[model samples]
Target: MFTRHHALRAVIVTGLATGAGLLLAPTASSVPVPDRSAEHALAALVSGPPAAADLALPRDFGRRFGYRPTLTQGLLGDPSGSCSSPVPLPAEFTAACRQHDLGYDLLRYAGRSGRALPPDARRSVDTQLGAAFEDACSSREEPLSLASCLAWADIAEGFVRVNSARQDHAVPESETVRSIAPGVGLGLAAAGGVVLAVPALRRRVGGVR
Candidate 1:
């Protein structure tokens, strides 16, 4: 009962539908799965250092940028480390601690690898940190907090290339000093002058990691 033209049209329509689905299948499967094991390992490295007042004090600053308290609670808690004197991390800093640890671990990997970050990895860090800076700057809160902005700037300096001429030059000290100066000035008004002594501290901390 089917006319030849009608049957031909039906066959073409089904073929197109099948072809369209096949084309979309690859895109759906191409998405990378979240690497939980890698993230956990990185998180452990972050929490391994003994908790200190200096480490925990940045929580309030992190809060200003919307660090969720519930999610950060256990993540920022104290870890067992060999510290002569240990300071308990405040509940407030949990989110900040986790965020800092993750960022630090990722950048540390890039640094230790002794090669350029893959394009996707580089873009991922750049986009996240850039967006955070923009959000911090746009905050309308009075006596505006720049802690997140400064912290992000510090993290960003590690990955952002300042000197393309050298394939293996360390991140410039001046850039880091400049980025964190505002945070130190705002957070530790009286001790702001001592920030210049950070290069020595950097050597110590760099060795520890």
Candidate 2:
């Protein structure tokens, strides 16, 4: 029989176990690599004096005239690409994901072409993605939906930040996509077991009362 003290202990244990599960949970998957040809095409398009001209176009210019065909093509190739996260993000996140992909593509292209961008450049891009996620989440109309969206946004941002931390900015992104180590999986499983036990403990405490 569970006493009040035992019930409180179970609650505390459940909280710790849940925290461990979260800490050990594997990060989101790696970003998908665009094709080499697509990368080169995008790189060439963004290079040269005309690139400056392209940027000078209004933000809405691409929406009107297909001004940024490379971006369109890239998004077309991977429409649902939410930074390779398996999480089901809100529809509003698509634009942010597209922009994030463009940023990463630029970094990858630069690295492959031997004109590697500074490490801070990648950090800036990742930061921008996080902000974009917040913006997207804030746009939700309903309060509960907004809160849920924000939570998912945090998860997505956390995944990318962890991924960015592991990356070697000096090299292309292709070299950085790696599977999580076995130890993390074990910890996650242990935490899950503890969390699963909470309901049984709660039932025992309720019966005693």
Candidate 3:
């Protein structure tokens, strides 16, 4: 008795919310400081999801670090300059090294400006290296050193925040994206409901639900 009642109530709540949300969702050309090119591009994707080639273009921060795939995931969740860092990640131990080796070559590009390392920064790197080495060593629960090195690199010290010469935007471009997302989300949810409410669509809805 309680199970059916709850499910019915939930469906009612979901449908009403979905309908109202879609009806009240934002519309085009409402943006105040409209960058039409960006707006058009986003609208195209919202109307239709991006093609694979569209996703192939690099984000600005990712360009800074070149082609490190996990740099952003390593550093931040962003998949940009964070983890798949331009700085070479430390290599895992091999049969020859005996001990775990940090065969990093990424720092070769650092300090092209000839700027001196501040004392604190120098200390931080030294401390991080020590911690990283220790982490990479014992973490190898396996009989081999290679396993430990892999575990530690997941949290190794790969961070350096550089100030970009370009000016930062005062307002977020995401603000516009945010405004558009709600409408698109409501539309999708309503479409999903229409699909779900049909008995013929039950199997597909089961997978989605």
Best by lDDT: 2
Model 1 score (lDDT): 0.38
Query: Model 1: per-residue lDDT, tens digit, 18-76?
Result: 99998888774575443333333333334443233224333333333333212233233
Q: Please write out the lDDT profile of model 3 over residues 33-77, one tens digit for every residue.
A: 333332332233223223421343234323543443222111111
Clashes of each: 0, 0, 10
What TM-score goes with each of the models?
A: 0.27, 0.50, 0.22
| C-alpha lDDT values of all predictions | 0.38, 0.54, 0.32
lDDT of 2 by residue, 12-37 (tens): 99999999997787655333333344
Error of 2 at 162 (Å): 0.7
Q: Please list all clashing residue pairs in model 2, or write none if there are none.
A: none
Query: Candidate 3: what lDDT?
Result: 0.32
The superposed Cα distance between candidate 1 and the true structure at residue 33, in angstroms, equals 1.9
